[model samples]
Target: MRAVIQRTFETALFVDGEEISRIPSGLTVFLAVCRGDTEVQADYFARKVARLRVFRDENDKMNRSILDAGGEILLVSQFSLAGTLGKGSGNRPDFGHAELPERARELYERVRDKLREEGLTVKTGVFGAHMYIEQKQDGPLSFIFEC
Candidate 1:
């Protein structure tokens, strides 16, 4: 599993011109399940993302986790994150590095539920849907997790 996480003041997802998920203040995470990913990878990812200390602290250090800040999570499925294509990850057709749709969807749903179970208010984008993910924060810190 791989994820590109961005801290945002707000985020939302829309599919077929209808809003599907939203968060007031939290991280907007774009995740992809690689072809070899399994439940163990998903579990490790959830724990790492949950403990990330990107939020600032009283001492001006990166000392606050999302759980500590009481923030939510906007999880979006982006299988393209795994696809590399011929010209790298640029504009081109995906070369089949990503997991199959059915498997990816299952893993994505699992990650979302697992995160929510960890006590964060987790919202999710529709799996396998053409959706738009909007992050409403500029200059936010971003991180990518591989697990």
Candidate 2:
């Protein structure tokens, strides 16, 4: 599993120019399920996101997790994160590492459900839809989580 997490002041999703989900302030997560990824990996990412301390605390240090900062999550499924490039590969990207859509969706939903179970509001983009995202980043703060 691989994920790109960004801290945002606000984030919104649009499909076919129609507004979908939005979060006023929180994290926007772009998740990808790689071939051979399991439920255990999915669960691990969820727990990490819930407790990862990326928010500023009273000391102006990045010491607060989403659970302490009080915010929502905008989870997006992006299989391209599993694509391979470089070395033997040429300009064209190879998606052989990406999980098939069916299994990928299952693991994606598992992460979403687990996040909600952690007691934080969670929103999502349409699973297989082509979405346009608008995000106001809290900073240049972004992290990649993989396992």
Which candidate wins on lDDT? 2
- Over 1-147, each residue of candidate 1 has an lDDT whose tens digit, in order, gives 878999999887899889998899888899999998899889888888899888888988889999898789999888778867566657876747788889988889888888988998898888888998677883568888877
Query: Candidate 2's residue-wise lDDT over 21-116, tens digit each?
Result: 999998999999999999999999999999999999999999999999999999999988998896888889988999999999999999999999
Q: Point out where model 2 deviates above 4 Å.
A: none
Clashing pairs in 1: none
Clashes of each: 0, 0
What lDDT does each candidate get?
0.85, 0.95
Off by over 4 Å in 1: 85-93
Question: How displaced is residue 98 in candidate 2, in Å?
Answer: 0.3
- Best by TM-score, which number? 2
Candidate 2: pairs in clash: none
Worst 10 residues of 1 by lDDT: 86-95
Residue 138 of model 2 has an lDDT of 92
